[model samples]
Target chain A: MMPTSPVIPLFVAVPLAGAFAIALLGKKTRIIPNGMALIVTGGLIAFSIIAMRMFSLFGVHTYKLGAWPAPFGIVMVLDGLTAFMLFTVSLIAFLVILFSISYMERYSGRWQFYTLFLLMVAGMNGVIVTGDMFNLFVFLEVAAVASYALVAFGTEKHELEAAFKYAVMGSVGSLFVLLAIVWLYSYTSTLNMADMALALQAAGSTRVALVTGVLLLTGFALKAAIVPFHAWLPDAHPSAPAPISAMLSGVLIKALGVYAICRVFYSVLGVSPQLSMLLMVLGVVSMSVGVLLALRQWDLKRLLAYSSISQIGYIMLGIGIGTPLGFMAALFHLFNHSVFKSLLFLGSGAVEYATGTRDLREMGGLGKRMKLTSAAMLSGSMSVAGIPPFAGFWSKLLIIVAAVQAGYYWFAIIAVVASMLTLSYVMRIMRYGFLGELREKWAGVREVPFMMKLSLGLLALICILGGLLLLPGAREFFLTQAARTFSVGTQLASRILGGV
Target chain B: MSKERQPGMTLIVKTVTRLTVGLILLYGIYVVTHGHLTPGGGFAGGVVIALSLVHLMLAFGGDVAFKTLSKSGAAVLEAIGALLFVGIAIIGFGWAGFFFNFLPKGTPFDLFSAGIIPLCNIAISLKVGAGLFSVVIAIVFLRVAGSERE
Candidate 1:
């Protein structure tokens, strides 16, 4: 059964209202911004969990705006895939915001930071929930604009330069997206994703649809920081404050880039074999190249930034396989990566917060002093590098097994080699930054403040337990359901439109 | 000769701006209220309203504009405008569905018709006007800060 829930719209509405409220009231008292951010994000996390449960029970839930019928007015759909994304985005956002409470005190304009952060969250939620293509682009812009400002929040020379480059690259990407939307609209005379899917399915694989797909692929790939289009990420990610880095690396790329690709190609355009091959090639290249670059970086955050590109490759490779098992692996990897990557970024933030530096050469042996943070970093590293019992290992193994099952032996080989490369660079960070002897200059470094530690501890705990998500019962609830959305392909339109 | 030493444009430009700024503001309001009936809606009207303030700032110095609406004041108004717009949507959600436009659609071409649209337009105008004005104010301040550094 398809249910209609009044609460669907609040996913976008509440954070928006919170952003403005912070802008208005945040100046009056310091506590208001902190309290409001916590409340908003915490509420969103609960709502998303409820949404996931609702999806499991109901199949697909859609809400029409202004009480209008689907195809004519905007709709917010909460299918298994969307519910999964909402849960991932909201969970990470809550943790990042918690970390920011302490981490951001070094910078001024606490109010502005909260306002922009909430706005970005609202935008991501909007993107996840909206059933309209144009609405997705609008929400994408909202998030992108907010992030650009946040990147330049420090106003340092390097920060400003990185932000400018990011804004330019990001705008060019958006232009491509807008152009693709225009092309799709002209071809189908509809901006709604489900409607467009039905239209294109009727129209078949025309030249126009092909062009639109290529355009969209180019656009979202840029946003996702696929290797060739990833010039801005290494600079921008490290340049932003730590929590912002966590948000950018953890969920922003997935929500804005990978999810869009999955929805557009698999559901709307109906992925062609050629497109699948292209995605696999991009995935492999990004995986190898990203780790190679990271192996050379001495900056803690920049190394992590490069690692993000490599990890994203693993998700993309899974998606490119285009099998049910492959889809499940991709979604599983996506969730696992979000948890552990954000944990890693937050752990780096803790180090920076304590030591006032990000260079690996300057720091050593703080593991004894900052026991919790080092432990958190260790778990995050183990998970990301695909060690046994960590979340990343299961997902990466699944992807390789699925690839081999599908007879793509070469892709499987590449994925394994990349996994080894991941371990190498991750170990480098541990050895240079955390594992060695204590530096004389950093002797006074204490653990970060309580809020920061709490956030790190919670995310690290998730990293350790994340493997449980792949257990039989839990897999059926989350991964299987989300993967089904992709496997259903163009039939998704019929499911949604028929439900309405 | 003394007037020429002022921080603004020539006296004639200032005088003309003073005479015309009120009219521009009125015209902007007219566009906003008549949005549902005419082509110019909230965004167009809002741009016009902001232009009036920009005219004031351009004619005199930013000081004169700051006196009328300080930076913080503009920020407050921008937030209020956004809240008002969202509030209307929430009210609609409460009444029916999200953005349901719950208010009555009165007689076509009538002043009080179109229910919440006019209210929405007013809210947008407040938001855009203040938002654009503040953007300009920020750029102006940035220039001042840069000059001071130099």
Candidate 2:
């Protein structure tokens, strides 16, 4: 049985408080904002580590706000999935903030950046922990709003245009989500996820349920940038500053998009064969479409953005298989993807930081001038391309194996082909951007700042060692436990509602 | 008249704003404080308050209105308001649990009842008011800045 712990609320609280603090006093001194951000993100990392330990030691931890019961007042839940996401979000955020300390110097309004960044982190943490659907929507909006502003932080033409497009699509997606929440509330007579799950189980499936489910699925799919709904990602992801890109690509989609879909479908509504198949179809389409479009991009960040969509497809395909192994593989891939994608984005940022260009053709033989960045790029590329001994390979292998085990040989083949496509684009990036003769215009280029390199090195190390997560003890403790949350399916509702 | 004139709208409009802005702010505060008992709470009250400030800006021009609340000042207030709200919620941790209403529940409809609800409302009003005002300030001022950049 899971115990009720108060620490769950801190995940949302710390970052929020930090955001406010930075906004309030940050203008007093430039150092105040980024320093506070680093401290807050670092604290959050520590708290998430503690939460993960608590989840393993105690079965699950639920915190009831205002000391009210679960069905009455709002509650925050800390399960294996929540713990896992917390770790991912906070880890990436901390490193990114560290990266931003020097990288953000080029832009003004440094405090504003930290404030919005923290707000985004707070929102993601809130989304991960909140036990209410409406509450989830609120957090999603918080993150979305902050991100829209962050994307336009540059205030340049393309940045503004991209931000506007992203904002419109995101707002529409949120509207759908809100509508679904209303539908679910009306149908279930409850807003809490666990209670809603029980209510849905008691009421059984209805037309209303199906409609709401599809509405939610579509909304989250848009946020996740899955194929049919992914028109905005390429523009937005490339237009934003690199750190924000890393955040959006790394954990935002997973936390707000894939994670939400997983929780609502598997736990709240109960997964069905039809829903599973729907997920698989969306996954495959997203994968194929994302990689195909990615191959044609010369803009480095745009290419990475498309690749993000493709990786998301892999995650969706894994989860859609609906088996325990598939679930595990999907989550493993989720972690690996976040690490390498963030690394890749940060690498691009480094390249842009030094060369002032994001076009792959504009950069050549940067390997000679920016040795650390090139090495980081190589590591990220290898991992993302599913090269052996790197994190991405193991996850991709697991996903394909899981697909094959589920008797979906065709999906396995598609995944393999997509993997090859991923390799081609990644290699293409390396060949043109890093390996050729040095461009004469970049003759005087230099490596990025120490902090930026530090972040890149850290992420690259994670990418290289990411495969260690598959080891026996780590696999059972970390990956399996998180997968078990979904594997248990609708029983989670009963468990949550039952109390210890 | 050119040397002596204040930087604002027509004298008549500025005079009218001077007469009513205080009343608007008062009404907003009333709505915020009475939120625990009445329908209008922080968000509504805050918007009202912000509108009053916006009224000041609209009538007296950016220079006169900004003297009362500069862009950064408004931002500071917004941040404080948010922090105040969250801090109150955290104070609940000291009582029963996170966000638990620990204060004694006085008689309903009283001015100081509902534990933290009134406090929360005030915080919300401050945030919404300042935040909205700042939005206006940013848009109004940013346009000038953007035009200058060109």
Candidate 3:
């Protein structure tokens, strides 16, 4: 067994501390919040890297809070999957915070923005690292509550309306999650995930387990914004400030929605064939419906929001395949989507920042004026549309390949069709927003500030190099390790419990 | 001051609030300190403490509440409370582990027993009390600003 690494808890601790510190000291000067946010996020990235290294070395490490033993006290687990998620979340959070330095200047209460941002980061990290069921719910709510407040930060009529909708929907999702946790707790008589997994296995599959599964699936599905549950996403994503938009679409949904589904279903509940089929169906519907809707949106952020739902469909399809290749592809696609989607959102934000409008029709030939931003947008668009040599292409190809290998040829064909649809809507943005004649009024438009450009450029670079993660050495080191965690299925209970 | 001319409610309400608010605040502190031995902990105690201030504001008006604890003061206290709580947990790293109870456990059922539990409760109460007060103040002030605009 691997010895516990002390740095594990800092993932949640550092951000929570930074948030409170910013709230207290930020009022004294503007620089305090900015400096604190940068330091905290930067520190988190370092810590996540350390955690990844630790995971590679130790296999699986668990930290028992307050020196309490497993099954009694809260434990934080850091395995390949947790480390992978930690890296993704922290990397995006650092860039978003970097982007926000300039992007949030237009809004008042910069301090509040930083505080909420850090709190959300803390919550996401908590969710990723927690080993207990109730603890996960608590952290999920923390992230959810912070995102809700951030969505309403602008306080405009539309922003307020969207935030209200998001809060109401998010609350309902959280209620379902809490109820499921309560039910699970009652059934297992323990909140520790490993113990509960063992207990569930001993009891075998029953009606209560089935009901809890449905409740959990519905709750996380709502958070993940899978198709029918995606009503609040389009409005909520666009209403927040640009950096916030990037953060929400980029990492929040994946962390809260997709990651939760994967962990709970695969590791705890143990996915059955029925559950797998249901997930695949959900993925296909979300993909086709989301892109079809995106084709009609005029607002840049709104279009991207819809695209997120579709891309999430790709990930769900990969996961539902339930093959080792499928798991790897899903995780690969998830990472690629995070980097490129964030780049896309930041690009949109830059466009809005320069032109004071989000309507695609109003933005014409922006590529000529804002060279850097447009280039970043192009990289993001191409990557997301699955053009060759880009990160998105590799992941999507893997998903389709995995589907076909699993004898789901129809699912493969649908995935291909969705890919084409994704390309069409993305091209629509490029044609209308960037390639056409320069608007007469936008003659004075310029590239975004240095920090925003830097973040965009860095994310664009990641998007370009994202496929390299599939290289044999890197693949074995990273993606395979994460997939192995899930491929073991319910045996994950013994794996984690053994560490204690 | 005349009853009707006061900024807040009637004279009887103000008198009653004045008489009870101190007792409520004291009780909340007791509850927080005695959390390890009793049903009420930081959350409940903090709510009660915040309600004491809320009771003050609802009776004597915003002016009186501001004099007791301003909005910024509540916000600062809230932040401080959170920092203190997290700090206590982080400090545990130097000992056995994160959130490890490093303090000596006195005697069970005693006021100072339970090691770090009382400290944690105090910190949580501070945060909850200040946070609740600030939330209420924000809502009340927004409402007042809205009504005055009309």
Candidate 4:
């Protein structure tokens, strides 16, 4: 049996404590909530790294809640994929929290923001770690509810409207997920995902399973904002305060949406060829449609939001190929997108903080005045546009290679064209938002504070060097292990059960 | 006549609320404590408790409600309640394991049985009661503020 670690529950516990503490003590002093959020997210980053190390030592560690054995009670599984997701979520979260330190000064009710932010982090951590399907659903709601509240944090006309629309669609998606879980529970007679997988294997694929898969795909697609279900994202993402925008576009969608879909499809439901093909089609549509919509946008954050959909499409397309290489590429892109996109969002926040505008036409020659934000934006844009020597290029290259190897030449061509489209809009952002003549009104625009700059600089550096993760030494412990977890598929159940 | 004409409802509703709100709160506590053995638990009991507070607000209006509990106080209580729940779960680590049920298990029907379950119920009730009441107060105050802005 894999030795149970007591530290597993702390992943969810620490953040919950921080969030509540913020609510209670935040009223007393502003610094308390700020310090509390930083410490909690920073501590989580350390814990995720530790978890990654633990996975290296002991392949899969399962912590059964209430000291109960698996298949009987709720279990938190710490595997390669879980560690990867935990690290990604906590790392970006810490940076975003840091970026918010000065960025949130203009807003009222700072405590509420920190409280909700930590709650969302806790929920994502819970979703990643939990081994039970229903437990995942609960955490998913926790994250979703917090995001809805955060989206309306500004209390503006558009903010409220976007939040309401987002909430309605999110609730509908959650209902579909809940319905799928109910169907799965009825069919498999188990709540534990590993146990359910074994049960489904024993029973073989049924019509009920097929229905459950379709329902789950639709639900997660809505969460991930893939193509048709993406109406709310352009509105909701930009409506939030910028740090939240970063969280929403950066890790939230991937953690609550893409990560859940991956875990459920690969490990639990077992990806079928038809399912793979369907995912590819959706990915292509999301890619082409997202950028086409983005090309017409002048609002800075809104364009980035649309670009987020496009990037998520790339990740999804990588997964759709259904090879070990495909899994690796998807995961790499997932991590890379989280970094660069959050950086971009934070950069936009800095610009808005300085210039007080999100419209691209209103900004110019920011490259002269706001040197740090401009540089960060340049790095982020370069990374996202698949330029050489940046992280995005490597992942996009791998994805294309994977597609070509899989004999889907059309998919490879679509990915290439999408990359070119990505370059065009990103260049537009640089040209209009930064490169041109300094606007008269923005002459006095100053750089953001130290903390925001630190966040931006760190993320920009990562964006530039993110390709090093694919090197032989780091690849084994990080990406390779995560890829192997998915490649094994239904065998995950047997491994977990056998280990216990 | 002036007292009755205060911003709230008539004296009849206020009198009824004053008398019954305490009883409702007491019953909520009872349900929370006996949650391990009874059908009602933290969530239901907490809702009942919050409803009693809401009952007071609806009868006497927000001024009286704010005086008793206040927005900040309710926030503190909710936070404490949540922290308490998490703390209890953490304390389980010292006994059996993470989230292990370590409390003394007496007879099934006993009020004090299922050790930590009762504690957890109390914590949850604290959170739910305060949280629900605070949400109501915020919305009510929001309307008040909106009017003030106009």
lDDT of 4 at B77: 86
Query: Which tens-of-lDDT digit does each residue in A243-291 have in candidate 3?
Result: 9999999999999999999889888988889999999999999999999
Interface RMSD of each: 0.8, 0.6, 0.5, 1.1
Candidate 1 stretches greater than 4 Å from native = none
DockQ of 2: 0.87
Write down the TM-score for model 2: 0.98
Better of 1 and 2 by DockQ: 2
User: Tell me, what's the RMSD of every candidate?
Assistant: 1.1, 1.6, 1.0, 1.3
Check candidate 3 and list the clashing pairs: none
- What DockQ results do all the predictions give, each relative to the true complex? 0.84, 0.87, 0.94, 0.82
- DockQ order, best first, reads 3, 2, 1, 4
- Candidate 4 lDDT, B57-132, residue by residue in tens: 8998877887878887888889999999998888888987666789888889888788788889999998999999
Tens digits of per-residue lDDT for model 1 on A1-500? 45898878988999999999999999978899999999999999999989989888888899998878899999888888999999999999999999998998898899999999999999989988999999999999999999999999999999999999999999999999999999999889998899999999998779988999999999999999998999999999999999999999999999999999998888788989999999999999999999899989999999999999999998999999989999999999999899999999999989999988899988889897899999999999999999989888899999999999999999999999989989998898889888889988888889999999999999988888988988898999988999999888888888889988
TM-score of every candidate relative to the true structure = 0.99, 0.98, 0.99, 0.98
| Candidate 2 Cα deviation (angstroms), residue A454 | 1.1
Regions of candidate 4 where Cα sits further than 4 Å from its true position: B145-150
C-alpha lDDT of residue A274 in model 1: 95
